[model samples]
Target chain A: MAQEERRILVAVDEGEESLHALSWCLENLVLQNSKDTLILLYVKPPRVVYSTFDGTGYLFSSDITAAMERYGQEVADVVLEKAKKLCNNIEKVINMVENGDPRDVICEMVQKLGADVLVMGSHGYGLIKRAFLGSVSNHCAQNAKCPVLIVKKPKPANGNQ
Target chain B: MAQEERRILVAVDEGEESLHALSWCLENLVLQNSKDTLILLYVKPPRVVYSTFDGTGYLFSSDITAAMERYGQEVADVVLEKAKKLCNNIEKVINMVENGDPRDVICEMVQKLGADVLVMGSHGYGLIKRAFLGSVSNHCAQNAKCPVLIVKKPKPANGNQ
Candidate 1:
């Protein structure tokens, strides 16, 4: 039987863990097949803090929001640039950035794109920390229709693949 | 440098999800290099009924404990046997079984073994179900020192990899 094309959606963030997962995907998940596509998804979280000026309570400023948006864009570009350098075939890569909660945005995009596999990196958060902060990869694993692959970067001693 | 011998630990259980992960490891993680090793870990939950029985009027029976142990062993063998068949090179595979909470046991074993990467299969349980029952893979991802890989089986339309 002919090999069907595969869509591998990788969740990208500013952390090293996400970059490790992206590298691993490039090395292992990106098939030699021409049809295979690697999607780099970077979800920019909604703003959490608003500037209050002149004793005004909870007033949002357009300037601050614009700056935040610019920061998000810079982050997306840096990570995507790093990912592209790691890939042998950069043309097969698709970069996507969206503003929302990462947990929901990732699941939604995976379904919308009909992704075959959702690749993620373990943030290396301790149990207690994860319990408090929650984990986007963990959430996607439970909710995404397709299978989720969470990749951890090898320890320093182990050396990279 | 010659490919350093790599230890890829896979968590196994009596579920299709685990077997799917084992298959995925064989096809993707297990390179042609003879130095690569695959470790299959099966964590059997501690007997919950025994503690309940001891508290209640009903006395714990040795017979029941023996039966439970036997069942656990049977499950371990079945999953490992299935995993072994999936591998092209069986000599590099190792099978281990432990009795404890799966979430704790899996993380402990991954560290104790100094595994390079820990591979697991997501149970495909929904968010609500996972919140009630808890998830082992999610726990391991958060706590394990090494990298964790959770493989999800492809959807029917996409066809299996």
Candidate 2:
């Protein structure tokens, strides 16, 4: 039987929760008997804000920013490594690391790349410090043009998936 | 049996969806084996943009705003009528409509009042909309002192209890 082809985009901060979110997405697709292309997108916001001192415009350098971008890429690598187990023909996986605010970038990239849905981890480092839903996921849910699947942080790992 | 009481604060707006949201919240509590007190909160933003020539502090006179305050009470009546069926040992229901930024007022009220959780339906209209969970629920989920339970707009009602 032919299954529905679903394109799933996940914002990977490359943490345990993100991996769990990816794991959940794959399970959901399996449950739906759907085939999906999974894009693991990561974003790096600049370390410093830039401003124009004169008409020359904002003085911003990409050298350190590029290194930070690579830092995010490295983190994406961590996510990709874990994703390898589920990277089968049923699920085509890709990685992306862009520089910008995570929230805006997720919605923009999903639209630009034509992803059908965004799957995100609800609680993250953002919540640990701030005590709320992760801002990146929250923003995507509010603004994404596509349906968003927010996976709650899994309860204390019970040695089970 | 003396059951633990459930307190829910519903953000009240004169919107089609807000009324539906209240209905869902009450139905949700009816399923659980406990009583609840429903609090209707309305937040009014500054009516006029202040000017230096306006010659007034940021906070204005409540007396001067009495008419607007009365409108707040009117919204309370709407909530009471809606809650009429859902009240059992539901205790007393009350309304509070204050003027300020919708987000700030919602959060401050949650902080000031002891509420177990907040429930909102996913859609808004008028100057303040529940659209995208409205700015209030969005901000409160991030900044409020309590847990928030949001009923997604267009959720599959599929005979869900």
Question: Candidate 2 chain A, which ten residues in sequence have the lowest lDDT sum?
Answer: A46-55
Q: Which digits, one per residue and each the tens of the lDDT, describe model 1 over residues A1-161?
A: 11457788888877777788877666555655547788888876666521321336555578867976787689778877776676656457788988776778889999999887788877622233234347777788778877677777667776763
Give the top-scoring candidate (TM-score).
1
For candidate 2, lDDT tens digit of each residue in A1-161?
Answer: 11356567877665566666666556433223335567877665434421211236555576855765566567557756666655554446787877766777888998899876677666532333213223676677677765555555534554534
Model 1 residue B66 CA deviation in Å? 2.0
Using DockQ, give the best candidate's number.
Answer: 1
How good is model 1 by TM-score?
0.78
Listed in order, each prediction's TM-score against the native is 0.78, 0.46
DockQ of 2: 0.04
lDDT of 2: 0.57
